[model samples]
Structures are given as C-alpha cells and as structure tokens.
Target: MRLFEPNTAALQALKGSNINITLDIRNQDLADLAASQDAVNSWFNTNVEPYLNDINFNFIAVGNEVIPGSLGGYVLPVMNYLQKILDDKNLHGIKVTTVLPGNALQSSYPPSSGAFTSEASSVMSGILSFLSAKGSPLMINVYPYFAYASDPKDVRLDYAQFTAKGAVVRDGSLSYYNLFDAMVDAFFAAMEKAGRGDVGVVVSESGWPSDGNGNFTTPKLAGTYNRNFVKHITSKVGTPKKPGAYIEGYIFAMFNENQKPSGVEQHWGLFYPNKQPVYPVF
Candidate 1:
C-alpha cells in the first residue's frame, strides 16, 4: 500500500493492518523539506511519529519524478537529511528514496544497451550511490503503455499487456515475452553499468488508461494488463535478467482524478470517483 503524504485519517484507518506502506512526500513540499531539517522533523512528528507503532512504514519516498528538472538538486539532500532523522528515531526499516520516470534512461532497447541519459546520470549517480550503500531499492514508475502508445508500429499490444505467447525480444540468452520485464531489466542493466547493480528497484507506479486514446485505452486492455501484471508479480517468476527475484510494485491510481489534465491522464484509475469499478481486475 502507498500514501502520497502522511494523511492522519488514512494512517489511523490503516493502523493494525499488516499492509506495508510506502509513504511519499508531496512534490510541492520538497523545497520546504530540503530547506530545513526542522521542517522535516516537524513534518514527521505530526504525520509519521503518531502512527509509527501501528503503521508499517516500509519506505519514505522523498519525491516523485522530480529529477532531471529544477527540483533535481533537492532530492539527494532531502534523502540524506531524512535518513539521518530516521536513524535518530530508530526507524531503520523505512528506506528513504525517490521515484524516477522511465525517461531517466537514454537507451533501453535491447535491454543490455540501457544507460541513463546524461541529464539524469549526473543526478542519479549520487542518489544511486546512496541507495547502494543504504541497501534501498530505487523507486521507478514503469509504464509500458506510454512506450507502446508512442510507437505502436513496433510494440505489440499482446507483449505490452503481458499476453504475448512467445519471446518478442531476444537479448543475449534472455527471452522477454512481456514489455514489463523488458523495461525492468533495462533499468537493472543501467544500474549494472553504473556500478550499482546491488540496488534493486520497486515499481512505484504503473497502469493503463481506460479511456482517452483510441483502442489502446479501453477497459478490456486495462483489465488485461493489470490482471496479468498482478499474476506476473505474484508468480515470483521475476524478469529474465533476475529470474525468481521477488518484485515489489503498485498500480498507478485507486480512483480516477477528473481534475487532472484532459485526456489519458484522467483515466488511469481502477475505480471511478463514485467508487464504481472500472472493469475490476482487483
């Protein structure tokens, strides 16, 4: 389970549950948290400290996809500060990390050829170093839907949705039948190249839109993708690159945000605002 922020009500409701939670710092508040340790302490005291005993705080994501941009510089500092605070409080299990978009990679095709873009590499090195030393997984938002939608001519629908019958891409001896595994392996490959292969990855966000884009965005495709994704993760088959390794992941949205920018962005939800299932894969 994940919460975008430390919502008191949500934390209270989830208390006593066995669910491990990945709590995120709001993107807009990254500046404040980075600016002062006092701010971080106060934020934690109010939002996290009160619920620590009951809530299983597994990961505390400093920011989401804020790298390779203006907020890029703040990520590492905030992570370091947050780690110190967590250590001081004896919250060792709660890993401090940040989420990055798939675009962080300059080349991902062929999987083995994966490398972080120059823009992302400089920022990533420090963060990846920290993760490697602390034994924390890098949070990545993997969406094969976007890759397929941008180039349907080359990306097969079945492969993207994990319904492919046979291997679609052959890298070395590794046979990739699904785009999800391929995308993930690409990141692993990049991490290996960066000399931080010890760091694992936790997929922070992934989902297919149920509307707003021709046949690519439909309830059937979304259902198929999400259902097969769940099965794939639970199977523990892992990616061809790391066979049998357990993967930790979370789907994009629990409810559709009608207020998001028009089109596909508003349609990634598993449920409607009215709490109705959008074709139920859960």
Candidate 2:
C-alpha cells in the first residue's frame, strides 16, 4: 500500500489505481479540531468525504511524528474525534492513528530494552488505549539510515543496509542480522512493555536516501535497501521478535521532494520528478 498526505492533485492522480492509501492530516491544528466537532466534520467533508468512493482509503494518520511533546498530547483526543466521525459516517474500513518517530522510544538498543521516553509514557498510554479500542495499528517511522548516519564509526554500513556480512547483534538469545529488524523488534518490545502487545504495528515510513552527506546515502545503496525491504516484507517472514506477524510498511516517498531541507530530506524518493524509476523497485 502507498501513503500520501492529502492533496487534491495527488488524490486525483490516484483515482483508479485501487491502491490502498494512508491519508495524512497535516499542517492543521489537531488540538483545536479535537475540541470542535464542527471543525472535524468540515475537514472531513472537504478533505475526505468527497473522494471516499474514488479513493481507496485505509488509514487516516492524524499527524506524523508529532507525539512525545506538547503537540503529542493532542494525538489521542484528535484520534478519538476523528474515529467518532468515521464511525458516524460508517467508514469502518478506514482506521484512525498517528505516526510516531523512532526517537519516541527512549532506548531501543538490544531490541529487548525498548521503552518509550518518560515524556511520552503518559501520552503513549492514552494513544495505545485509543488504538486498542479502535483496533487501529500503531504507526511508526523507522529509519536505520539515520542510525548509521549518526554513528558511522561504530555502526556497520552493511548491517544498516541488510547485508550484515555474517555480523549479528546478539540481544539475549536472539540474533539480529539487520538494523531494520532490530529497530522493528524494539518497537514491539516497547509496546509490550507499555501493556499493549496485542495492538498491531505498521511501519508507516521506512527508506534510505539516494543522495545525502553520508557516503552510504547513494543511489545504489538506496535501491539495494528498498529492493531488499520489499523482498523482506513480501516474504512474510516477519521480524525475529514478532514471528509470522504481518507488518505492513510503506516506502518513504514516491518522488524526491526538492522543497525539503538540503541534506537527506530531498533524496528519499523511489522516482524522479519526470516519473522515471530511480531504480527497479519491483
């Protein structure tokens, strides 16, 4: 499934693809919307209801990586209001959730030691409760690239790219061969510790940048990472921690967004602006 922040042109472009979409609600004051039923209704009517039939909407992400802070406090309330609107409108197929950054967790090393930060604990609890009640998956954006970029001296490039070269991270008896798997398992561990192990996880965003400051952020490596990722998820092998569990994921972007910040931000695209493939993704 592909994810897109709601926009008229993009939605129009996807009219008949029948591809599942995770629509994002961005740039709006979620707190204000949560407090007012009229605002939520109007926003939905303008942004979603009109395209309900033409678009294959599966999830509504309230905000991307906005939690663990003051803005994060609005997540649960906004999700509740949005979910109620969906239920009232009989939109049962579309689940409401928010995307969280990998940094939301205070610690993720060793995978098993995963836990949300103290600042995020209370808010995450409420978010988890809402997700559990609504049967929505907990969305998280995991980027092994950032981890490697932060510590190139210690972090193995091969491990971050899924080519571990026989290297394994021993977290207890479990051995993690790749950073992606370890990162995902860490989130699972955190969720379990948070008392909501049953709630499913969706990798809302994961990808490598083709061009950036780091040496590893090259077109070839990006292609390799994405291609391997597609294979990994499609094989249904799951991660070591959540064996046999189906974890739905979406690649970071469809095109290189030039307006984004200078470094890696503009380079996480699978395609160029002219619609040519960056690499053979399939």
Candidate 3:
C-alpha cells in the first residue's frame, strides 16, 4: 500500500498531471496554540507557494468530518488556522475550505428544507460568513449511497443512481429525475436559510462505490451510479434549482486503494489499484 503524501516536489507532479486534488488536513495540528509560527511559514512557503501555476493547485481543505455534530469542535479553530496561513503567505487564487459532510445540513431531500443540525448552525453560520468575506466557496462531501445503502428499500435506484427515473415528487410539482440535482438543491436551500443563498455550492467530494462489501447493495450499482453522475456533471446542465450556475464537483477519487479504510469510502473510486478502469469513463 503506497501512502499519499504532498510536498513541494510531489505537488508539482500532481499539478503537472492536471489533477485537481483537495488535501484533507483536519487531523493535523494547525490550530493548536503550540503550533509554531515558523512551521506554518515553512509549510506554505516551502510546500505550497512554489507551485501556484494553474491546474497545479485547487484548494486547501482545513478539516474533514469536523462538523458540529461529529468533530465540529475543531472546525472554528482550524478555520482560523486556514485563514492565517493564507494571510501570512499573501496567497491569492487558492481556496481555503473546511470540507463538511452532508449531514451539516438538516434535511437534504426534495431539494428544499435544508437546515443545519442546530449544533452545527452557529458554527456553520460563522463558517459561511467567513467563506463569503474571504471570497471562498464552501466545500461539501456528499454520498447518496450512504442514505440509500442504509435503506435501499425506500430509495429509488434510478433516481439515486442518476439514471432517468420518473421525475421526483416535490411540492406537488413533478420535478427532479436525478438525485445529484436534488441533493445540490438541498444545499442551496441550506444556504438560503443561512441567508447565504447567493454563495456558490461546489461538491468538494461525491462518488459511488464499486463494491459494498456484501452490505446488500451491489458494486455494479455503485459503479453505474458514478459513471452516470459524471455524465450529468460534464453535460453542463446545472442543478434544477440553480440552473444559472454550473454545478461543479470533484469525483471522490481517481484510483482505488486496497489499503484504504474498509467501507463505503474506500470503494468510491473510478479506477482500480492496478490502474485498471472500473468502467467506461464516458
């Protein structure tokens, strides 16, 4: 199992490959009081700043799964850490974000009624405020399979998998054939509630698994779900709610790793370990 590490040299190769990578660093101690100023200076100066060329850089993720309901206690401070790094480096163009799990929103179905968990709202309010002021977009990691895998009997396969399902039932309006758009609308609703409706929503992470580890749902379904998702994304047709804005998403992964955690996350890659294509990319 090869570990994924990012450094000055490694970052250059990654950017040269034209891969927009989002680095998750919530586990690191960037926000700690004991964190050295020199260390932070060295990091951005030595590791990040050297390679600011287009296509070589995308975003710097401050936290992962560190929302109020789960690990949010770390969010406020980590967010500050991100801000300081950006300011100290005098950097521009790179986005600083805290990649939040979808649960940060209260209800994410029907493309509306999006709210925060209450526990996360105040902190998220602060977060959205920061993103707005900083001209940075919020990052969200969503996976329909988790909701569907939890209750496959209730969730429709075609809609959840991005296949052409009869339009979904919403507010007495026959709308939404794919969950991607519906899911995005849910986030849009969340921002509206937060008074940040104008803020752009980007899928920090989203993907379907190629295997369910015998959890009842099959890998084939997950793979098909991923392929179709990319289709809708690349088609340039934005979400039903935000037709004016082109929905942007970074597919969960480029390649599968056998050493990755055993669960839905590990299998959420388009390619297998040996560089084999899981399915037709188109």
Candidate 4:
C-alpha cells in the first residue's frame, strides 16, 4: 500500500478525477540535465501528455531550494536548462521554475526590506532578468522553522506556530507578526534590489512541522499548524508585511515519508504513507 501504483485499474479509473502530477526534480544537477530530460520527456510523451494534455496535469518545477550551493550547482545552470527546455519543446505556460531557499535573500527581518545575498548577486541578477523576460515567477522555499530552530530564543514561538506573533523588525517602514509574510516581503525586496521589482514571487514549499521536540514541530502541533496554516493562506488576508499582494504559497509534502532518511523530515506529512489523510484536510 505504501508503494505508488503506477497503472492499476484503480489508479487509472480515478486518474482524471482524483489527482495531478507535479514533476519536481530537486536532486538533479545541471550536468545530468540532458539524461534526466530525455527520461522525463519519454515518460511525459508516452504516459502523461496525450491523455492529460487538456486536463491541466502537467507541471515541471525544475529544481528546489538550491540557490545556496557550490558553483555549477543548483540555481544558475538549472535555470538555464529550464528555459531552454520550455523553448525547445514549445511548452509555453507550462510553469517551469527553480525554487530558492530563504537564505538567498539577505534582508528578511522586517519584511519590508529583503535583499538577495551578495554571494548570490552575480547569478541572481541574471536569473531575475531572465525570469522577467520569460514571465516566470521567482520560486522560494520559506521555512520559518529554520529561523526559529536556529535561534529559538530570538524567534517568537507563536509566530512559528502560524497562529500568533512572529517578530516585529520594521525595515523601510513595515511591521511583521509572522515569518511567512516577512519571507514574502523579503522576496519583494530581493526583486526591487535586483532592479526587476515587477516580477511575481511564488512560494514553492512551506509548512509547519506536524511534530518535533522543544521547537513546535510536534505531532499534535503539526496538525494544528497545517490546518490553521492552510486556512490562513487560503483566506487571502495578506501577510502582515505586504498588505495587498496575492502572495501564492504551496504547502509541503502530502504524505508522511517513512523511508525518508530521518525521523524529523519523514514526519512532515498531511497523510500517512498509504495515501490516507493523516488528518481531515477538508
């Protein structure tokens, strides 16, 4: 039951009505781009595109949280490959993107003044320009957990809980309660600093751990965080930082990954391994 049923009758029977496939290859590097692309292209062409072409099920997020790695690493070359792939395949509007870590932005405190780190400036500048030209939104993985976990004393517990005050560090005149909005505001600042302030920023991955120790990632807390986080995001109340931008954010994994290496990471799921809801999401 834990295994993914590739094409059983049950899967095919409910495919159109039940689910969508988002191909996210975060672990792949640029050097392996061609081989990976070929494999993916084959899969999509033979399996997904034909039946699901008009169904809006095809999405390719080329990379994830990779902006702070070594050179010839995640952000730069992959960005190049993403653009080329879309152009070559004529897959316009397919929503190709590379999600960056929050660290990519230097200013994240007050939410009003976020800037890309100096280390990221060289390639980030090119990326911002390219995304603007291609009309692709900047993708970011904002984990307020890391901030809290890194310095729990400094970060407010309630803010990380997604149901209370986060922190209030005003920059250029703006107040913030939670790290989520501050994260988004930082992205806006990154854009402005990059000289491409008009490009849209999208949240690729976010979530409150269902459970952890000492920090608020506990199982009981996880359920509360996920449930309220969804409500808060979907409500469109705007982040305390930016009051009017329709900041698009996507929650993290849908399933609890038992085999996912560590206990902490494996615990971050809305469902248990067998495609069952861990809690009532609806």
Candidate 5:
C-alpha cells in the first residue's frame, strides 16, 4: 500500500498480516527534507519508526515519478539521506528508492535503443549509483495503455492486452509478444546501457483504467489486464531481457479515488469507493 503518513490503527491491523508494505514519502518539500537531517529524522520517527515492528515494511519510496526535471536534482540526495537514516536505525531489510516514469527514457522502441533522456542522464546516474550501492531495485511505473492510446492504429489491442496471437515486435533474436514485457525490457536495456545491469527492476505501479475517454478503457479490459499481470509476475516469467527473474509489482490502486483529476486519472482502480468490485480480480 502507498503510505504517506502513520495511521496507528491501520498499522496495528497490518501486524502479523503477512502483507508487505511499500511506504511512499509523498511530500512536495523533498528538497528541504534532503537538506535537513532533522526533518528526515522527524518524518521517519513519526511515520515509520513507530510502526517498523508492526508492519512488514518492505520499501520506502522516496518519491513517485518526480525526476528528470527541476525536482529531479533532489531525488538522489533525498534517497541518500533516507538510506542513511535506515542504515543508522538498523533497518536493513527496508530499501530506499524512487519510482520513475516510463518517459524518463529518451527512447524505448525495440527495447534495444533504451536510454535515459539527456535531461535525466546526470540525475539518473546518481540515482543508479545509490541504488547499486544499496543493492536496491529500480522502481518504475509502466503503463502499456498509454502507449497503445498514443498510437492505436499501429498498436494492436491484443498485444497490449497480453493476448497477442503473434509477435508484434522483434528486436534482434528477441521477439516481443506483449507490450508489458517490451516496456520492462526496454527499461532493463536502459539500465544496462547506464552501466547498472546488475541492479534489479521492480514495477512500482501498473494497471489499466476501468473508465476513461478511450474506447479500450472498459471494466472488462481492466480486469483482464490486472489478472494477467498477476499471473505473469507470480509465474516467475520475467521480461525477456531478464528471463526467469522475479520482478515485484503492485496494482495501480485498490479503490477509485474521487480526488484525482477527471478522465483516466481517477479510474485505475479494482474497486469502487463503496467497496464494490468494478470487476472480478484474482
């Protein structure tokens, strides 16, 4: 679950539940936090320290898709401070990383020409260095829906939905049958080019919207995508680049959030706010 603050009762309920939690530091003042050790300490002390033993905290996401621009400069510093804090507190099991958007790359076609955008190169280098030092996986948000939406005429629905009848993309000897694997493999190739091939990858967010402006944004498709994704990850059939490697992932959201912006932003949820399933998942 995406955690912004410490909720005592909620955290208590998670104790012994066998559920892994990924805490997201959802604050806009990331630069200030990185500059101030006391702020970092206070934030962690109140939000994470008290619940460390109660919740199965697995990863501490420094930020979500806040890089490759003005705010990007603070990412590595913030992650470094957070990692240092965790190390000092003996929280070795919990990793520190940031969630990157697929657009962070300059190019991703063919999954072989993957590379970070020029604007993001310096920041990405630092982030990769920190992740490598900490032995943490690079968390990225991938959405095949956006890709298909951008070029529907060229992008087949079956391929995007992971039910491709034949290979839709061929990169050298590697043939890609679906967009999900292709997108992930693209990121893997980018990491390899960045000289961080040993670093692992994690899909921090991925899910299709049940309702949106697009024709494909239907409840049935959303359920199908999520269910297939669950099976894909659990089966240990990793992306072609890292075959058989396990890649951890999380569904985009659990409930439809009304606070989100209109259109597709508010629809990527498995359940309605009233606790009703939009469509059967799992």
Candidate 6:
C-alpha cells in the first residue's frame, strides 16, 4: 500500500500486518525536508522510527510526481538525506525514491522510442544516478487509463483494460498486448536512454476510476483492469522487454475521497467511502 503522508492513525492501523508500505512525504514538505537535515531526522523519527519493528516499510517516496516542475530539485536531496538517516540507524531495508508521472517522458509510443523530455532528463539524470548507486528502483505512476482517455479513437478500450485478445502494438521485437506493459517498457526505455538501465521500476500507482467518466470510468471497467492487473503481476509475465522480471505494483487508492478534485480523480478508489467495494477486486 502507498500512503500520501505518514498519517499516524493509518500507521497505527497497519501495526502488525505484513503489508509492504510505500510511504510518501508530501510534495509540499519537500522544500522543508531538503533544506534542513534536522527536519528530515524529525520526519523520520516521528513517522517511521516508532513503527520500524512492527511495519514492513519498503520504500519512502520523497515526493510524488513533482518532476518537470520546480520542486523537482528537492526530491533527490531529500532522498539522499533520508537514505543517510536510515543508514545511520542501520535500517537499510527501506529504500528512498520518488514517484513520477508518465509525462516525464517525451516519447513513449513505439516503446523503443521512449526518451525523457528535456526538462525531466535534466532532473532524472541525477535521480537515476542516485537510484543506480543505492540499488533502488524508480517509482513511476503508470496510468494507461490516461493514455486511453486522451486518445480513445486510436487506443482501444480492450487494450487498456488488459482484455485484448492478442498483441495490439508491435514495436520491433516487442509485441505489446496491453497498454500497461507498453507504458512500463516506455519508462524502461527512457531509463536506458538516461544511462541507468540497471535501475528497476516499481509501479507506484495504476488504477481505473470507478466512476465520473461515462463508459470509460465505470465500475465494471475499473474492476476488470484491477483484477487483470493483479493477475498479470502475480503471473510474473513481465513486459516484452524484460521477460520474467518481477514487477511490484499498487492500486491508486483503497477508498474514494470526496475531498479530492472533482471528477475521475475522486473515484480511483476500489471501495466507496462507506467501506463497501465498488466492485469485486479480488
């Protein structure tokens, strides 16, 4: 599971379970954490140190999808500081990274042609270098829904929902049957272009909303995509580019947030705020 912030209540709720967490330090906190080592230490002590023994903290996302923006610079510095804090405490199991949206890439189609935009390249180069050195994976928010939504005329719904019967796109040797793999491979290609092919990728967020977009964001489509996503990850049939590689992923949310910006953003959750599942995910 991925938490946007270190909510003490949510942390307490996850106390004894074996759930691997991808905890995030809100984007707004990046500048503060980057400027002061003391802040980073306090943040860690307050949010992580208390539950170290009970919760399985996997990755600390310093910032979410801040790249190609002003806050981009702070991401790596905060990650470096957080990594040192963990190192000093002899807690090396948790990795430090940042989440990036698909727009980070300039060319994603054809997968082989994937390359980061000039802006993202400048930032990701350093971030990718850090990841390579730390042996940490890059967290990418892969949303095929966006790709399909933007160009539904050309991008088929079956391809995005993982229900396509066969390969829908062929990029040289890579035959992409689903948009998910194509999107992921595009990131891989971009990383390779940045000279860090060794760095792995984790799908930090990916889900179709349960409502708010007519036929595109219906509960049925959302459930189908998620259910197939779980099966695809568990099957270990990695993308065509990296066959058999284990891909760790997480759904966008657990429950609907009415407070979120209206429309599809507020409906990515698998369950309603009332706790009833919008659709059977498992």
What TM-score goes with each of the models?
Answer: 0.95, 0.94, 0.84, 0.78, 0.94, 0.97
Worst 10 residues of 6 by lDDT: 257-266
Largest TM-score belongs to which candidate? 6
lDDT of candidate 3 over 119-221, digit per residue (tens): 8787788788878888777777777777676777887767678876577646335278877677777877887899888777667777777664564345677
What are the RMSDs of all candidates, in order?
Answer: 1.7, 1.8, 3.5, 4.4, 1.8, 1.4
TM-score for candidate 4, please give it.
0.78
Tally clashes: model 4: 8
Deviation in Å, model 2, residue 215 alpha carbon: 1.8
Could you tell me which residue pairs clash in candidate 4? Answer: 166-177, 210-218, 210-222, 211-217, 211-218, 211-219, 212-217, 212-218
Scored by lDDT, the top model is 6
Q: List, residue by residue over 1-282, the lDDT tens digit for candidate 5.
A: 755445677778888787888888775868788787787888888888887777789888887787776788887877878888888888899999888899899999989989999887888888998889889999999899888888899998888888888988999989999999999988888989999988898899999988765577888889888998888889998877789987998898888876643654648888888989989987
Candidate 1 residue pairs in backbone clash: none
After superposition, candidate 1 runs with Cα above 4 Å error? 258-261
Clash totals for all models, in order? 0, 0, 2, 8, 0, 0
lDDT of 4 by residue, 1-282 (tens): 111213435335545563444445535444465345575555446444555543443345555655655632554555566556567768775665566788787776666567888877766787777778878777778777777777889887677767674346565556666667777877887788789887776676777566544445666666766676677678877665456656566677677767643544546778778888766655
- Model 5 bad stretches (over 4 Å): 4-13, 258-261
Model 6 has an lDDT value of 0.91
- Per-model C-alpha lDDT, please? 0.88, 0.85, 0.67, 0.63, 0.85, 0.91
Residue 22 shift from truth in candidate 1, angstroms: 0.9
lDDT of 1 by residue, 112-195 (tens): 998898888888899999999998999989999998999999999998999999999999999999999999999999999988
What local lDDT score does residue 186 receive in model 4, on the 0 to 100 scale? 79
Question: Model 2, 1-282: lDDT tens per residue?
Answer: 554466788888888889888888773667777777788888888888888888889899988888776788777777888888888888899999888898899999989999999888879998998889888899889898889989988888888888877747998878888999999998889989999988888899999988766566778989999998888888888888888889898898888865543653548889888889878889
Over 175-212, each residue of candidate 6 has an lDDT whose tens digit, in order, gives 99999999999999999989999999999999988777
Better of 4 and 6 by lDDT: 6
Q: How close is candidate 6 to the true structure, as a TM-score?
A: 0.97
